[model samples]
Target: MTPEERSLRARLAAHVSWAATPDPASRTAKARAAADSKFEREAREMHPDASDEHIARVAKHLRSAHFSRMALKAAARRRNSATPKAA
Candidate 1:
């Protein structure tokens, strides 16, 4: 590529990379919301006869598990990001 074109491409890549890094608070909140909805749906399906207190406890447990899974996935990405790529 021409020097000017290469420079422009580099700048664009940097900008895109910076823009794509999610806000941690927003990401966590979104994950939690998704987990909450998922828990509600599954609880409703599997425990139609469950009481309010039991449902609350089950929902909390399920959401926490989902959040923890998300966290572990994020950690794995961070851990693997530094590895060298295959040629």
Candidate 2:
């Protein structure tokens, strides 16, 4: 109940509220959905005889791998941008 603690709590609450808002129409959101569907389809095609559980697992793995790769690339881009460029 210190003033500084209250301010921090308010800012954190605001951030959490803002972050929880969903935007289904955003391009990135749509792209992510499309990618997820594509992964599921690809998994199904690759293992036509597999059980639903297996296919779902494969699709989940594919989506996770894809996003992890994207995150790595984004981090690399940020690192490169922050580095001083040679004249």
Candidate 3:
């Protein structure tokens, strides 16, 4: 995997159980907070010469992954609900 993809996966892995979260709004808030925290931590760990672009890239990847996970969970819930229970 590319460096960007690996970084994104690491960020996503840091925050688990996100998909199991029931409320969309709550899940979004959680994701945002986690992303922001991770970004700041990463920035702090980077060399002083590092640029904002790197931090932004990480944040973007995290947010995108979070939403993707949330969407998948919501779809799964919908599908399960739609399926009739066996007698």
- Per lDDT, the best of the predicted structures is 2
TM-scores for all predictions: 0.54, 0.59, 0.46
Supply candidate 1's per-residue lDDT for 80. Answer: 95
Model 1 segments more than 4 A misplaced: 1-38
lDDT of 2 by residue, 13-62 (tens): 98887687685357378787888889999999989999999999999998
Candidate 3 lDDT by residue in tens digits, 5-58? 999998887565555667778758887787688856665465356677776676
Reference-based lDDT, residue 16, model 3:
57
lDDT of 1 by residue, 47-82 (tens): 889997788788888778878999999999988997
Error of 2 at 13 (Å): 22
Candidates 1 and 2: which is better by lDDT? 2
Number of the top TM-score candidate: 2
Order the numbered candidates by TM-score, best leading.
2, 1, 3
- Residue-pair clashes per prediction, in order, are 0, 0, 0
Q: Using TM-score as the measure, name the better of candidate 1 and candidate 3.
A: 1
Candidate lDDT scores, in order, read 0.83, 0.90, 0.75
Candidate 3 segments exceeding 4 Å error: 1-35, 39-50
